[model samples]
Target: MVDAHETFVIIGGGLAGAKAAETLRAEGFTGRVIIIGDERDHPYERPPLSKGYLAGSKERDSVFVHPPAWYAQAEIELHLGEPAVDINRETRSVTLGDGTTIQYDALLLATGAEPRRLDVPGTRLAGVHHLRRLAHADQLRGMLTRLGRENGQLVVAGAGWIGLEVAAAARHYGAEVTVIEPNPSPLHGVLGPEMGGLFTQLHAEHGVRFHFGSGITEILGQDGQVLAVRTDDGEEHPAHGVLVAIGAAPRTALAASAGLEIDPATGGVSVDAALRTADPAIFAAGDAAAFWHPTLGTRLRVEHWANALNGGPAAARSMLGQEVSYDRLPYFFSDQYELGMEYSGWAPPGSYDQVVCRGDVGKPEFIAFWLKEGRVLAGMNVNVWDVTDRIQQLIRNGTTVDAERLADPTTPLPE
Candidate 1:
């Protein structure tokens, strides 16, 4: 039998890190489990920050991955509000911000990603915001509530998933929202112009002003409070609040400090199919890990709930010397106004040859497939349910499906 005294250290207080700690104990690892987080709050999921929490539909405690007492009950030591400042691979030790050093037999770097901030004049103004953390969401909820009460204007930069979701939340609060994006349509790089235009129409219908093909050059402020935003097109928009949703960057300083290989394609720490880093003792997961997929033959960093939900357990098993291949497909879901969407697999706009809609695009429900040489690379279901498994199977199977049947609504998807 293996020694029960082995120590496993997990960095980052997000969903992946929390799940890893839970999995270790559940898998019967009688080892010392330590989870260190920079944030003061308990580990929580990020998706609810923009959706349920921001909309005031979910309680604050609902965001946490587990109850506050669960850690103590599970024998998982938590170092809350303490950030890991250094990683010493030679000693297999990590130093916290408080100058405490911890030794580990295995290490998991689940540091997650940080929201990309805007660089412009007056960006430091009081009304400017970026949603990434639970605390930020709490502050934003109060801000949106006040904005709704006052009918204030909110100008958001970058029409990506977060930006669009925030716009929907603002509208839910009865606040005026204006989105500024340089692309031709919202999510142009992800969903392409054809699909992105749908979102453009969706938000516009709810009174959101879309200033496409333009971006914010500066935030106009008066006495440390935002008053308006100046666009690159030399247009000025009045705003009571500004949200910078440009996107996020992986937190790889710890990985880089430990001399782990960084994926050039993605700015995340590179790991093998087993989520193992260059050092066998170190593994990475969640937004921080750009793992190689055996099936896709490429490295990808997925910033979604599903990745953290599944990746951590896989990495935990691998750390326990169990065989594991973390080849889960990239998946994400989004809710905006009345439209709900679930997307599976990776089909970059340029990578796909054509997009086939299974139902009428004008209708409220449809399944869109991005295909290349008759092979499905990605599938997105709009207002559709319970087809994620079938869609992923198609992508994994790599079958050359008939385009005609795939487009016919009456034809059922292959099992």
Candidate 2:
């Protein structure tokens, strides 16, 4: 049990860390709270980096999790640009990058994840970039704006959410864009082929070209600047800039170095239902935590915004010796061009037996549900507004539904 005067330290000043700090104060903890971050900027929302921020529709201050004054007002020490390098479990202390050591009664690791980089040659070129931080997005936005003026091509590697969103923003800036994905279709692994095909058609309508079933063998460049990309098939595509959005790897080195249990499958800190790590004094949240999900009956790590937002408070409550379960339905949303979408619940690959669609796919607006044994496991609504609550309720209820009624738009979801 932690004393009222003991210090609580949090690593990684992203949304999860910020939210955790907020929860601690809100819960009336009088102990000192400190947030350490590697980046110079304060905690900020990352979702806008690929959407409004990249498109220049949102200002720099709009992305911050809280204004600069909030941390000081809350009496939370902000350790900006200083990363936690080592964790000493025996001493219950953490060593910062600057070699300062701080003792903690309780610690939260919300280290988050970093973007995976393409290992191809010329990745070091001036025109090549990856989107994981505000600085990266700022650089890409500048490049896209210049490319728009020059009518240059923007070659994006990977057709995942980040890649597609970047492509949409670049297209909106009037830059010619091409997305390269090794998968057969965009988001095929998550949404399945049918819904993935809809995204393909949507991008095609906006004049975005796709190179499917192909991997980038090399990034061609001249004079330290990217010029084009060479695919495995020996085809060269023009490129004034390149955005690599393959995926993200969890930031688990600190947890692993501390001899904490790490999930080898997901490269995340292994945690129980309460988000407590193997060490009683330590806990993890957000992207770095592979937590046991009671509903799914398995361990899973989510990188979505909602998970961090909700998980922070849950982790804090648990740390305060309150009974808590961080098992809310995993939810996420994305916006590209004119289309907006929200997905809820867990539908692991190959776990669902069938998919039922409500509304017309041709209209490019509908809700698709993944089911097993006629029970809804997960659902996604694309370009359809105000139905996410119903979709989540359907999954939560886990009631068997008639396929005919599920497919019929006129039939109410609860019916």
Candidate 3:
């Protein structure tokens, strides 16, 4: 049992840190808990920043995980805009950016990640932007609203979730968007070919142009303003503004400098099943921690909102000496140009021998199941959310269902 005065220091005031503090209090720890984040605002949801928040449909406070007053009520001290500059494992203390060190009985490193910058010339121009923070989204929204054309051309440099979601928001404002992907289709590197094909056709139907198999060599600009994007094919595409969404790397400098073990394979901090690092006094979670998956038998690092919110409490329990392990059934959702897509479970590499499609793909309403050696590996639902619950259950129980029944469209995947 922990004493009431034992101080718990949590770095990174994102979803994971906030939830950890809440969980500690809920479990009757009553220790002095503090959350330190680099962002000035209260911890907010990143998913909305690309979708509703970027579309001007919501306010800044709408994305906050909890209001400012909530922190005071919970007695969880929040060090907003203050980042942990250094860590002393021997002393068990964390030095803040303002040059103050705090001792702690336990520490949670949820520093999250920053936007990966592009290396090409003219990337430093004014109109070139990356959406990772709420402030960034606000600036992007203003830029899009200022463009003021019914079919304004907005060029996206990557086809990741953030890029696609921003494209959907731009299209909502009647902007003619072009997505330039190095791959043949969106999400090809992550979801494979067939699933990415569905997204390609879906966007094309909504009047979004795709420049597939093309790489941006340079982002040319005039007078500190982005003017056009030049591809490796020597074709210059006119773009009012360019968005780089090439993904992010783990922010592990503080922990690494403290002599923490980082996994070379995933570039994430190595954590045990209990979310603890090499030092039992320290732990990590969210986008910065990588753990081995029991099902896939490979290290997994998921960058999704579900992982932060769900995995946060699990890490908190482990830090409090509870034996809970964070082996969640992974799930992610994406919205693009009026299409809703969701996926669950780890899709093993080269696992699917047969893919059964239920319902019509052309109508934009269907579900596809990947079967590996007569067992379910992963499933994707387009507009069908009814069967997702059952599909999730089937995945949990490792139930094998009839492949023929899956294709009938009338009968969903069995539970």
Instruction: Give the residue spans of candidate 1 off by over 4 A.
Output: 1-4
lDDT string for model 3 (1-415, tens) is 3455688889988888888888988988888898989989898888888988888788878998888899889888888898889999889999988998899999998888888888889888887889988889988887777663545578899997888888878877777788999998898776778778888887787778899898899998888888899999998988888889988889989889999989998888888777889899998888898876665566777778888897778788888999976777678888776688888877754757877788888887988777876677778888877666777776666767778876787663552
lDDT of 2 by residue, 1-415 (tens): 2245879999999999999999998998888899999999999989999999999899988999999999989889889999999999999999999999999999999999999988878899999999999899889999999999999999999998999999999999999999999999998778877578989998999999999999999999999998899999888999999999999999999999899999987789999999999898899999999999988788999999998999988999888988998888899999998899999999877889999999878887889999999999999998898998899898888889898899999999878
Q: After superposition, how far is residue 345 of candidate 1 from its true place, in Å?
A: 0.5
Whole-model alpha-carbon lDDT for candidate 1: 0.93
Candidate with more favorable, higher lDDT: 2 or 3: 2
What C-alpha lDDT, on a 0 to 100 scale, does residue 143 get in candidate 2?
Answer: 97
Cα TM-score of candidate 1: 0.98
- Model 2 misplacement above 4 A: 1-4
TM-score of each: 0.98, 0.98, 0.95
Least well predicted 10-residue stretch by lDDT in candidate 1: 1-10
Using lDDT as the measure, what is the rank order of every candidate, best first?
Answer: 1, 2, 3
Q: CA shift at 30, candidate 1, in angstroms? A: 0.5
